[model samples]
Target: MRTIRVIGIGTGDPEQLTLQAVRALSEVDAVFVLDKGSEKADLVALRREICARHAKAGLRFVVAGDPERERRPADYAGTVEAWHAARASLLEALIADELGAGEVGAFLVWGDPALYDSTLRILERITARGRLAFACEVVPGISSVQVLAARHRIPLNRIGAPVHITTGRRLAAGLDPEADSTVVMLDADPRFDHLDPELTIYWGAYLGTRDEILRSGRLGTVGPEIRRVRAEARARHGWIMDTYLLRKPGAE
Candidate 1:
């Protein structure tokens, strides 16, 4: 039987690769990479760099075009399901063609695979189909959330209070006013503006890289700046991955 190791390569920094991840990379016969097009070519380049540094000699790469996802579909859940199905089909084909029995293959995921990434879910779908025969092992890596907290020099939770982690859409709908601290990820819009103006925000972009940007202040005063900076960064890089922490005053 073949094995697929889903290794988290951390954020943009090549040094974020864990020792275990390096071992996994060295053992893999092939690494499966998803090409997100030229707009995000830098991302693909980073993955290539990781393979170049850690993968064993003669290791091959199976690059597959990522399935396009609907940005604003009315049926968001249905659209995502369809997209995952398509990705599963693509991965299944790649594994069957590229991986031989007893050989190891890997997918270098950004951040922890158990986080927001869909690689593990897609792989589960492929396994459920029973057409592919491969065992999977996940090696956790530092997530952007951890990096954000570390860079900001703040704890994610407030004392014994719980921390709520959510996305922009959920944030726009609204968050619990009494909630201790809320961490927002995948927010392309300024949803934080709707929250309490007195709330504090710690924002970071392009984390773990030379282009990193950080901002922290009262939401009312810093919210607009975050929106502006985030927009300019996106325009400059053609892509951006940002996460922010919103905390109520005196919560800590």
Candidate 2:
């Protein structure tokens, strides 16, 4: 049976890859890539650089066009389900056509696959269809959440306190009062803009790369600065990937 390794490539920094992840990359016969477009071409190029550094020479890269989906839809969950289905179909064909018997294929995912990434889920969908016969393996890597805390010199959770990880959409609805510390990911908008002034925020963008940006302070005082800087960085780079930590004072 063909094997598919869902290797977590961490963020952009190639040095962030664990020895185990590097070993996995070196073994794979082919790596699958999705073309996200010109604006995010740097992301694809970064993946190629990583493969060049770690994988065996002459490793094949199978690139496919990423399916388009609505950025904002009335039914967000439904839209995402459809999008995943499309991706599963695309990847299934790649696996069937490109992967030979007993050969290894890989998807170099950003951060940890167990996090917000959809590659694993898409693979599962293809497997559930029973058309593809491949074994799946996951190699973990450093996540941006860890990098954020380290860069900011702050613990993700207060002493003996729990940390809640959520998205920007849920953050806008409201935070759970009991949440001592919250980590927000995949937030394009500044949902923390209207939050309590006393809350502290540690925000980072383009994490683990040379273009990394970090900001932290009371929400009220630094909120505007974050907004302005985030906009300028996005405009300059044509894309942005960010995550943040929000904590209540004396939550512990």
Candidate 3:
């Protein structure tokens, strides 16, 4: 059976790679990268740089086109499931065609595989099919959320209060009053505009990289500025990966 390593390389920073992840990369015979088109070419470049820094000298890189799905589907979960199924199918073919029996292959994930990433789920789907047999392992790395807190010098939680992590789509519905802190990820749109004005926001974009942008203040004070900056950054870079921590009025 072929062995697949789902290694987390962290958010766009080669140095964020853990020692364990480095060792894992050294063992990989080939690494698969999903091309998300020219708009995110820098993401692909970063993956290449990470492999160059850690993987064995002769390690191979296999690039494949990522399947696209609706950005604003009526059924978000269903759309994502379909997209992941397509990814699983593509990755399965790549592994069967590119990897030799008993050889080790890898997918370098952004942030911890246990987070919002779909690589683990895609691998599960592939295993469920049982058409191509491979053993999978995960090596965790620093996440963008961790970087956000570190850059802002704030903990994710307040005292014993629980932290809520949610997507932009969910955040649009409402913030949880019971949770003292909320970390919002994968927000293509600025959904926080309608949130409580008194809340404080610690936001970061393209974190752990030189292009990192950070903003912090009362939501009412910096909300508009963040929206402007975020738009400019996205337009300039053609892509942006951002996350923010929101603290209730009295939580801070």
lDDT of 2 by residue, 22-126 (tens): 999999999999999999998899999999999998799999999999987899999999999999999999999999999999999999999999999999999
Query: What's the lDDT for candidate 3?
Result: 0.92
Candidate 3 regions exceeding 4 Å error are: none
Tell me how many residue pairs clash in candidate 2.
0
- lDDT per residue for candidate 3 within 84-166, as digits (tens), equals 99999999999999999999999999988999999999999999998989999999989999999999998888887899999
The C-alpha stretches of model 1 lying farther than 4 A from their native spots are none
- Tens-digit lDDT track of model 1 for 1-252: 999999999888999999999988899999999999988988889888999999899999888899999888899899999999999999999999999999999999998998899999999999999998899999998899999999999889977897898888778888876578988888767666567899899999999989999999999999999999999999999999999998888846
CA lDDT scores, all candidates in order: 0.90, 0.92, 0.92
After superposing candidate 2, which stretches have Cα over 4 Å from the reference?
A: none
Q: Candidate 1 clashing pairs?
A: none
- The window of 10 residues in a row where model 1 has the poorest summed lDDT is 186-195
